[model samples]
Target: MLDIKLIRENSEIVRDSLRKRGDDEKIQMLEELVGKDQQWRQSLDKANALKAERNKIAKQIAEVKKVGGDASEQIKRSAEIPKEIARLDDETIALKTRVDEILMRLPNILHESVPVGADDSANVEVKKWGKPKEFNFELKSHGELAESLGLADFDRATKVAGAGFNYLKGDLALLDLALMNYAINCMVNKGYTLIEPPFMMRRSAYEGVTDLADFENVMYKIEDEDLYLIATSEHPMAAMFMDEIIDEDKLPLKYVGFSTCFRREIGAHGVDTKGLFRMHQFNKVEQFIFCQPEDSWKYHEELQANTEAMFQALGLPYHVVNVCTGDIGNLAAKKYDIEVWFPRQGKYGEVTSCSNCTDYQARRLNIRTGKHGGDKKSVPHTLNNTAIATSRAMVAILENYQNADGTVTVPEVLRQYMGGKEKLGKV
Candidate 1:
């Protein structure tokens, strides 16, 4: 949600942002909100004037009665004023409700640093890490290699749970657990408090962390219940401090949330139907931060650097891209995606995304910070990044570490976590 005061004072800025975002419909809605607000203000003023008149009349009637004069006419007039005031009050409340409905539909204001673009193709690559290796032999895709080694069982998974699901068997299952433990430990070393939050959240709380449209497409709401399964740990972590005020000293709060995330994948077809690229459920270690407004940009960079370090430690080649305007979404003012290289596909696929939401979510969640009665309250900024999505990490590992003899070499950093196992899928 955007600040209505900002829209009232700087409507041109909001209009131009919507234009740049390719959302003319919201621009029209802004006009409606302004009109309704004006009417509400006028009605409120009328109601206040009537209230003042009623008070004065009551005083006049009391004085007349004290002097032994008839006060019946004054009493009748005063009663009529209250009925009029009540009617106008109802009108004002309706107008305010309409205005609020439109406000929720408005997107966040774009930051000045964001690039103007329509889609991901317009996104600019800011940096590149390690190079993609040259293979002397034909490289097998992650799915092919995992199935041949009896490490992944998609057929049984489909029979058990339908499409877009898989079962990791043998050493691959162990590798998945190793990746989760490794990522959590890495985050712990970086001073983030580790939390395993609830896998489900109430609809009211969920709305605070995501766009309203997501309720229909992305989320899995339980039938006849107010609860919805979380799509990421970020959702629950971000809502942890909803409708609360924190002390200024606790400005920069950080957490590494681990959970089993679920997505509906409603329309996904003919894409990664055989592998783990797009799954209905997966494990993730996510990074979330809440900090003062002045320090959010600094924390955004630090968050990006932290994810890059994790990838480098795992020996995965990746690059960073500055997300374009349309593709960045409304939650984040600016975003950076770390696309890790997949040797079999000959392309870099997105493995992690870091976003600086800059108070956009804070406003919706009503999260603020200030001293008690000494300083003015202000909304804090929010940021989140994927420390590691275990499935995608496994995808990169299976293809990049594949040997000519079909054995998979474990990344040196994760070997200790996997009980000193150096390789997987060996007979």
Candidate 2:
């Protein structure tokens, strides 16, 4: 959530940001709601003054009655004040609720560094690594190669759980674990703490971490419970410090979270329905950080650098894009995505995203820091990235490393994780 004070002081700047992002419909409503907020505050001030007057009269009436002096008229009028105050309080609460609703829909102000663009085409390709391999014969997609090697079982998976679900069998299952463990180790070596957090989070906590639209359709809410399955390890990791204060010395806290994340994937009705290109559940080693406002940008770079390092180690072809303003959604002030090459798909697709959400999430989650009543204190900034999401990585590995005869070569970094196997051949 944006700071209410910032909204009040810079309404025009906020409105302009919304307009630039093509969120024109929300501009007028923001203005009207802010006006109501101002009126509500004014009425609250008046109500306080009136309550003080009533209290004074009540005290005077009590003394008058004790002395056997007449106090009936003052007492009768003073009794009406409570009802009026109650009415004002109700109005104040209603207006405050409306104000909060508008604020939730408001997007964060774009970082000056974010490139101005409408969609993916405008995203700046900031980096590239490795080259797509050449094949002596036609390369098969990962889904086909894995099926032949008895490494993945999509047919059985669909029969039991429907599409977008799969079973990683034999070496494939081992590879998934190896990749996540290796990613976490890399993060740990860089001074990050490794953590395995809850796979489920309360809906209220989900709201603090994600956009409102995702709550109803993208999340899998447990019936009769306030909790929902996590869409990413980042969700639980980010929520860890809710309503808590950290010491200033702990600024720039970093952690690597591991989990098998679940997602509804409602928007992907029939797309990539065949393979690991998209899946309902997959293992992930996520990077999450909380830091001082001044350090968030630096950490964003560090996080992206870490992701690129992983891709480089895997020896996969990939490119990095600076997500444009419209493509960033509302959460991030600035975001970057790394798209690993998928040979079968014939183009790059996002395998990882690193974003600097600034104080937007921290404000909502109440993640604050610094010395007790110290000058340097406020809600800390938040950042998260896909250190590695197994599903997409699986797609890249299978399609790019496939042999013409239908064997799949494992990447060198994952060789030990695969028990030193050089290739997975036909079953």
Candidate 3:
């Protein structure tokens, strides 16, 4: 939630920020909350005054009783005061709940530089890499290519555990592992600490880490349990320090989390259902950071560069798209997605997303700090970048490196990781 103090003091400024996100309804709600707050405060003031009068009259009654006079009138007056104060207190509590509820539902205001638009179609392209390779013969989708190379088993995977699951055997499994290690190494070299966060996260903890809507759309809630299968290492890895204050000297703590993430794949009925591109489970090396608000944007660029470097090394053609304000989603203030070109699909597919969420996520999680604990307190900014998503990367690797004779040539950089093999052709 955004700072209520800021909202109350500079509501128009906040409105303008939200306008960039095209959230007019939320802005209206803020105005109504302010009115409720004023009414609640006035009632509280009246209730407090009545209580003060009651206390003063009680003291006089004690003096009168000591002098052997009637104290019945004073007692009756005090009784009314207690009832009045209690009623006002109840109203105040209810009003506070309403205020907090609105605050929680309001999405983060967009950063000034975020392009204003409705959807991905309006997302601006930041940069483009190598062109999609031209093929002399027919190009096969990742599913066909992997099957031919004895890499993936989709039918068996579905038999074992419903749809949108996969079994990456042989070189494909090795490739997934290699991608995870490769991404982690790159992030660590760029000053990120590597972590293997727990695979399962409780609903309470997960809620602090992501938006409420994600519970239905993206997460897998454990039946009859309070836990939810984590959709990304980002969830537990980022929530580790929830409701905690960090030392100023420890500013900009960065972590690269590697884990197999699980999602429900809800509403993805007939979308990307063929291969590993969209799956119930996939490996990911995620980059998460806690930084001073001022440093988050700079770190955002650095994170993008790390992902870009990895894509370039993999010998894949790709482009960077600056996620527009509305399309940037609720968490991130500004975002960039690295979309890799798939020769078979003949379209760019997202392989990485780098976002600077500013202080939005931190404030919700109550992750805050001050300079030396005595300085100005503020919510630390949080940022997450997809260092590598193995599912999507496989699409690029299989399609880009496919040989004319049904072989997949491993990128030169990954050869060392593959025991110095020049190519992943038929053994």
On lDDT, the candidate that comes out on top is 1
Per-residue alpha-carbon lDDT of candidate 3 for residues 210-317, written as tens digits (9 for 90 to 100): 888888888888889998888999888878888788776798898999999898763343323378878888899999989888898899998898889999988799
- Scored by lDDT, model 1 comes in at 0.89
For each candidate, the alpha-carbon lDDT, in order, equals: 0.89, 0.85, 0.83
- Please list all clashing residue pairs in model 2, or write none if there are none: none
Q: Lowest-scoring 10 consecutive residues by lDDT in candidate 1?
A: 265-274
Q: What TM-score, to 2 decimals, does candidate 1 have?
A: 0.93
lDDT of 1 at 235: 97
- Rank ordering of all candidates by lDDT, starting from the highest: 1, 2, 3
Clashing pairs in 1: none
lDDT tens per residue, model 1, 1-427: 8888988888899889888888878989999998998898999898888889999999999999999999999998887787788898999899999998888878888878777889988878999999887889988888888899999998899999998788899899999899899989999999999999999999889989998888888899899999999999999999999998878887799999999889987345442325878888999999999999999999999999999999999999999998888888878888999999988777888899999988889888988889856568999999999999999999899999999988889999999988899998642
- Candidate 3 off by > 4 Å: 44-80, 266-273, 371-375, 425-427
**Shift of residue 300 alpha carbon in model 2, Å:** 0.5
- The per-prediction tally of clashing pairs is 0, 0, 0
Residue-level lDDT tens digits of model 2 in 375-419: 776889999999999878877878887777777778898888767
List pairs with backbone clashes in candidate 3. Answer: none
lDDT for residue 8 in candidate 2, whole number 0-100? 84
Q: Which one wins by lDDT: 2 or 3?
A: 2
Clashes of 2: 0
